[model samples]
Target chain A: MGKIALKRTSLYASGASPVNLLQARFYNEDCLVYDLEDSVPVQEKDAARLLVYNLVKYQRPVGKYVIIRVNGIYSEYIDEDLEAAVRACPDAIRIPKVEHAYEVQKIAKRISEIEKAAGIEEGSIELWCNIESYLGVLNAREIAESDPRVVALALGAEDFTASMKAARTKASLEIFYARNAILMACRAAGVEAIDAVFSDINDVEGLKEDVKLTRNLGFDGKTVVHPRQVDVVNAAFTPSKKEINYALRVLAAVEEGKRQHKGAVTLGGDMIDKPMELRAQTTLAQARAAGINV
Target chain B: MALNIKQTAVAGTMESSDVMVTVKPAEGQGLVIHLQSNVLTTFGDQIRATVQEVFSDFGIRDAEVFLVDKGAIDCVIRARVQAAICRASGEGFNWKGEDK
Candidate 1:
């Protein structure tokens, strides 16, 4: 299958929790992250790995992109996590606390080895690096372009704020630079950029505002901790009806101009240039991904 | 394929669509299973068959398996059983050999 272009929301389900893992696929999010990192306690790591492996292999969720968030690269459990996760054949393996390009390369190399040993196609599994520290933000560009398997870079705001010794707020002013830095890196590398999770699950209004900011800042998606946040983020990322209509009209105008052999395509008395055409195409693509007819 | 059951271990929970499985070294008991499920009367034979299949796949001849089911399906039952057996055996799973 082809890659998913519009991943509006990636929902995190604790790997150790059977109920959550079973129900994760039914949610409206574009991606499902079976997390074995911070969400699983140290004692349950082994059990969680086994559970996630079975769930991914036998009862693999359909219609949604599945990713397994392994432990940190330097941790003792990383090798085992990769061994199980790679064999499980999730769409991607999320590496936490990535600060350099070499880390991604090394992990990708190990993933290749596992794939070969398991008889799975090499490079079939992808990677998602989590940038949670100041150094990670600084080296974001190199990390995003580090390896071909690296498909996305996600900002880990809770840890990033802690690393900077700054407080996390609803306004998210503290990690503004990190967010933009990751976004810029992803854009430059032609990969997707996923925003951090909105920690406060109860504040629906706050989550809506945060999602709006996430979309306005040009993020491809957001990581949601709670199931309730999925629809809000998905809705915010999906193209609105009015925007879809304008994109359709812009494409039609371009086609008409091509048929007439005109120098420039004008939509509603305004010239539609390259950037506008590209934006219109992207809007329609996103609409299509969200299941809109147009 | 030989796993030594060194300790008693438990996996899973009593939540809806989940089953809590506990495995213990039964020495000479030869694969005994005590199961309690809300849907026991409806799915009793199928659940037992699933548990027996997991133990047979693991090459276990003797063990005490206790399961509390809350309407878990076949896959969930298999996962929880494997988790409990692995934990009790104090060994990492051989994914290639046992996962099929």
Candidate 2:
């Protein structure tokens, strides 16, 4: 298949725990990310890597997007991590701490070598670059446009906030600029952008509010850590009932305008042109993909 | 290849339903197992049997396995032991999640 569909909920589970792995695979998260970065302890990295490799190679996560979060590009474990990652044939490889375009290029090179050696197709595995550092946020556009294998850009809010020496608040005003910049870069590159995880998992209301912010920010999806958070994510990514109705009306108006041989149309006293029609079409498509009854 | 312990290696954690398996070279003629588990009273023999089964599968004849179990299941115990033995045998790229 082409690059895996952008899932609304990307769940990050600990690679060291098989129970967590099973949960993530069976859960509602459309994307399952086996995290070998921060979740695994230093000494347990090998164990986690082995388990993740086995899960990717031996077992099939049917109806799920399987991704691996390897160590940071500059970390010591990336080489070994990618060795298993490429051979395992996961849908994607998520690289953390991506500050420059060269990082993605280097990973793409390594993946190319592994694909040849493993007899897998080159560029089969997609790359998701996580922007966490100040430089990463600054060079988000370059990183997004770095390589074709780099299909998605992730906002690593905790690390970004720490790097900026800014505090996270209920409103999250500190990292607003970074989020907007990353999303803008992804838009320019024609790639998907994922929102960061809501660390306060118990606060369902907070998660709902956070997801609304992400949706308004034009994020393709949200990254969640807990299984319970998937529902909120899926709901947030879906176009609401009101949006679907408006989109349908807009499309009908566009169709009428087309039949009348008129390029310009009006809907609800507002000018409806090609751009608005395209936006409406996209909204309806998203709602359909989300299984909404629109 | 026969499984031979080259160094001391440990795998697993102290979390609930987890096990920490440590392996070292055995000076004796065969494998020796020391297990600590919450269900030891009823399942001690079964757990030891499972460890021995894994050892036999790997063709390990001389090694000391120290199993610290926190109610881990059979598959997890097997994986932990497999990881520990792989590390102990100085297996390259195995611990890094590579095939062979």
Candidate 3:
């Protein structure tokens, strides 16, 4: 309530297929989403669920966002997915390829009811919408603003590429429109826009560029696929020291303005009012969330 | 045998024959850890590795550690492990600065 930090966004990372060994590694990532959806295969679903559940149960990391992306809506095991996720009570459940507001409403409603029945804290498990298809891209705004519990939006690159009949390249040039669309939708709806994962694990430089693009485009965070990707993603998403120094100056000016009974102030000769104050506060929030002291 | 992780409050007593020290958090912004030691020295790198490995799963950054031996059984190990977690979690805030 002190200050709202919009930059404190959550990220989801996709684990490799063979989960057990690497899962612990991926779950340890700095991103908020430890995606279980695309990473876990149909066969290892149960084991993955158990592993996630145990980890969450015994050790709840303080202030870290850890949501599980359950299997897709069409997966035969959505019910099981819900059961496992509901039992675990992660910060949220990410639904892939959400085509309409109704999809979000339905999942939100179901999770709400389950939380009621299970006696899990109401609103403990929120919803995350993934815009993966043409329909989903069209409905992105509605999906982002649909449910109060739906706090984040994600781009599903592979499915979206296939749906658009675009080339799947290392640079991800084809999905530019969709990416911007999703980001706009998220910003409009007052939620976080998460960039899609870089599927090609070998393209570290390409991944870095993609991360930069998304960050520049106002993405809150990007989903990662490998442990190697985690460090870079974490680094890129974090507020730079220069930004933090600016934020500190902004906060200082705001404080001084408050003492002087002025509604606004200036920092480094730049106006520091509501919007600027909000942005600086958000920057600080993000830095703090990422363990950056500034 | 079920692996055991245990610790005593800074004010409490811990006498270890086997001790494993796991700093779940290394420096800044510390966090939770599960430490186990048998005959203290026996814990060696494996105990250190296990604790480090477990801490990674939780993404813990900064933490402190200590272990004691009484030639504990597996169950004792589990109890001590819980205690270690509790202490690290700041449950023993009152015992901060007391001798082990």
Candidate 4:
């Protein structure tokens, strides 16, 4: 669970579409999720799996994290999905509708077996668990800590609201609790928390506001359905110039304090402690990941 | 290898960056490929060579392969052909064994 690079936006491309798959890497999103779950038609499952396998194995995307979103844990397609996805060797495999820690463990076990059989380095492939239901949200912490392979827990609000039998709205008052619960769980478990997608692709303003809310709520990133939303999300997640400058000052003050053999670290007459230093480091890390000079 | 073409099967779409491949049993005829691509003048030979290589990899000597290419790359072409042949043969793909 060490620090990883910033993943501000994860874009979804239909697994069955060859055109989309080929063009996914050129986009600005930090992560590209080739979806094989809800996006592919039932009859086209085999076709989509083969296409994704070939795309990941032969024409793998460079300079971006690649993940394959498989079917639900209970679905019959999960086995075949894991088999092909593991062999394809993407950065991670995202499992949808995960409700329990055992589901994560079960899939991790299966992935381990596949990796062993395929001669792939064991524990190389990671997993991202999607929390789509009330149970999943309640058990988010356990799911996040279920296995070492579980790196992030993403909130799937569309399905969560459906599961709660509630209406979905633009303000997103309904999913507020679930969002916070997931964020806290990810923080407690020392894993990344991803927010749900903003479904209204046409409303750029609304999308920007939503990204603002996601960043304010301490989410690591947001799931984006379209390529156009990538820059919006990445911009919202990146640390601002003012914040980066303050972080640089904080780190410099800490270094100066160390050199002076001082007992306390201070910048601008305010006390700087461990948490503040860590936050400053994280801000600088995010800025660096965003390709800033700092 | 050792794929038996039991029936006609098709894979892929006619969209851009994709190729629609239809494989049919041509017992006596040896590997007949009818390819129509938008980039036929420039990439026709390369595309045909890719198909031929896939056929050789699958150890198929007799089949009528019909492909309508929309400027698909080599990987897409290879995937569509393998999918079509696997569907035609009514068998699961031995991905590890058929490492290309």
DockQ of each: 0.51, 0.25, 0.02, 0.58
For candidate 2, list the clashing residue pairs, or say none: none
The local lDDT score (0 to 100) that residue A140 gets in candidate 2 is 98
Candidate 3 residues lying further than 4 Å off, grouped into runs, are A1-28, A32-36, A58-63, A247-281, B1-100
Per-candidate count of clashing residue pairs (backbone under 3 Å): 0, 0, 21, 0
Which residue segments of model 1 deviate by more than 4 Å? Answer: A252-271, B98-100
What is the full ranking by DockQ, best candidate first?
4, 1, 2, 3
Model 2 DockQ reads 0.25
Candidate 1's TM-score: 0.93
TM-score of chain A of 3: 0.80
Residues forming the 10-long window of minimal summed lDDT in candidate 1 chain A: A1-10
**Model 1 chain B weakest 10-residue run by lDDT:** B91-100
Q: TM-score: which is higher, 2 or 4? A: 4
Which stretches in model 2 have alpha-carbon errors above 4 Å?
A1-3, B1-3, B14-19, B27-61, B64-79, B95-100
Candidate 2 on A1-294: residue-level lDDT in tens? 444564799999898887787567777888899999999988878778866776677675887888999998878899889987888898999999899999899999999998887778888999999999889999999999999998899999999999999897768888899999999999999999998888998999999999999998789998998999998889888888889999999999988998999978898899997778888988988887777777
- The deviation in Å at residue A82 for candidate 3 is 0.7
Model 2 residue A294 CA deviation (Å) reads: 5.0
Model 2, residue A103: C-alpha shift (Å)? 0.9
Query: What TM-score would each prediction reach against the true structure?
Result: 0.93, 0.87, 0.63, 0.93
On the 0 to 100 scale, the lDDT of residue A13 in model 3 is: 43
